[model samples]
Target: MTGVLIPGPGKRVTLRDVALEAGVSIKTVSRVVNGEPAVNAATAVRVAGVVERLGYRPNELARSLKG
Candidate 1:
């Protein structure tokens, strides 16, 4: 699963990638990553697992721009 999700050595895993791998929407993956309480336990756990497996991370530059 990890091998399947990782783009390459230089490529960083994106949230959208996690969502696709987890079979959830981007918004749902975002909610989980942000540690929002809107997502249920089961979904959150599943998303978290995918996050870890894919080494997915929110882009700091993107976060800064959004902020």
Candidate 2:
């Protein structure tokens, strides 16, 4: 898959992009995206906003590998 973080015509946005845009660590973005407990609600909300704005989506293959 392409490494592009900004989704455009046929491009897939990534977690790293969300983190960078959200001004948080990648792990924090992961936690927020995965619905993991312990993330601050405010932070999660911020990350979610960035995700929506950036059109970010988790790579399913990488997600499965993480599990």
- Best model number under lDDT: 1
Task: Give me the candidate number with maximum TM-score.
Answer: 1
Which runs in model 2 stand beyond 4 Å of their true positions?
Answer: 1-8
User: Each model's TM-score, in the order given?
Assistant: 0.87, 0.76
Per-residue lDDT of candidate 1, residues 16-66 (tens digit): 789888888899999999989999899999999999888887788989999
lDDT of 2 by residue, 1-39 (tens): 123356568777777878878888899998998899879
Candidate 2, backbone clash total: 0
- Number of residue pairs clashing in candidate 1, backbone atoms closer than 3 angstroms, sequence gap of 3 or more or interchain: 0
